[model samples]
Target: LAKTTQPISMDSYEGQEVNITCSHNNIATNDYITWYQQFPSQGPRFIIQGYKTKVTNEVASLFIPADRKSSTLSLPRVSLSDTAVYYCLVGDLNRDDKIIFGKGTRLHILP
Candidate 1:
């Protein structure tokens, strides 16, 4: 598993775009960059995943560079309800690996 680093907290106003970046210095070739968003008293919800280049869904977009050492989760026109903790994980999702959850980046959407 590749260790990830992310900001402790971020703040943005409603209707503004929010980007959270994570760094995985020891990412492996088979590793995939996955992002999750979690609200209070709820499990982490899958946001996006990408191996390289860029991936976009209706919810958010994920960007991964060629080196795969870093990734960014971009949320367009965020709202107050989108406030949550965002987690960045790097690993092979095929096998049953013991996944560890760290203190993720807490995103605060202000009015």
Candidate 2:
């Protein structure tokens, strides 16, 4: 598993776009960059994932650079309800590896 680094917290106003970046200096070729969002007492919800370049879903977009050392999760027009802890994970999903989650970035959507 590739260790990831993210901000401890972030703040954004309603209707504004938020981009949370994650750094994985030792990413492997088979590793995939995955983002998750978790509210209080709830399990982390999948946001997006990408191997390289860019990938987008209805909820958010994921951007991975050429080196694959870093990735960004972009949320468009956030609301107060969007506040949550966002996690960035890098690993091979195909394998049965234990998922180790670090302290994720806490996003605060302000009014």
Candidate 3:
């Protein structure tokens, strides 16, 4: 698994768009980028994933650059209830790889 670099914290008001970027400069060809969100005292939940280009789900959109070294998770119209920690991870999911959770970016959504 490749270590990811992300902002420590971010803030946005309700109804604003929030984009969190993660850098995986040493990502391998088989690596995939995944994002997760966790609320206080709750387990983390999967948000989105992508190998290259864009991937969108019901909750968010993931955009990976052609270089496959970085990705951005886009959250639209975030509300106060959307406040949580967001994690960006990279690894070869095809293999028996263990996904390690790190200190993710804390997103604060203001009213």
Candidate 4:
């Protein structure tokens, strides 16, 4: 599995957008970059994923560099309820993986 590093925290005002980036310089060929969002008590939920190029869903957009060494997750027009922890993981999604969550990027939204 490829190792990933992410920022510890970020602050944003309500109605503004947020973008969080992760680094994985040693990413493997079979690895895929995945992003998950977590609230205070809920388990992390998949936000978006990609092997290359850009992928967007109703919630967020994931942009991956050509070399796959880094990825950025963009949250559009965030509100106070959007405050949460964001995590990045690099590995095969179909495999029995035990991903260790980092302290993660704590997104704080102010009204």
Which ten-residue region of model 2 has the weakest summed lDDT? 93-102
Query: How much lDDT does candidate 3 score?
Result: 0.90
Angstrom error at residue 14, model 4: 1.2
Instruction: Give residue 78's error in model 3 in angstroms.
Output: 0.5
Cα lDDT tens digits, model 2, 3-107, are 999999999999999999999999988988889999999988998988999999999999999999999999999999999999999988688666668799999
The segments of candidate 1 whose C-alpha lies over 4 angstroms from its true place after superposition are none
Q: How big is the positional error of residue 15 in model 1, measured in Å on the Cα after superposition?
A: 0.7
**Looking at candidate 2, what is the lDDT of residue 18?**
98
Q: Local error of candidate 4 at 83, Å?
A: 0.4
Worst 10 residues of 3 by lDDT: 93-102
Maximum-TM-score candidate: 2
Task: Give the alpha carbon lDDT tens digit for every residue of 4-105 in model 4.
Answer: 889898999988879899999988787888899899899899899888999999999999989999999999999988899999988875676665566689
Taking all chains together, each candidate's TM-score versus the true structure is 0.95, 0.96, 0.94, 0.92
Q: Give the runs in model 4 whose Cα sits over 4 Å from its true position.
A: 94-98
What does candidate 1's lDDT look like per residue over 4-75, in tens digits?
A: 999999999999999899999998888888899999999999989899999999999998888888999999
Candidate 4 lDDT trough over 10 residues, lowest sum: 93-102
lDDT values, one for every candidate? 0.91, 0.93, 0.90, 0.88
> For every model in order, what is the number of clashing pairs?
0, 0, 0, 0
What would you estimate as the lDDT of candidate 4?
Answer: 0.88
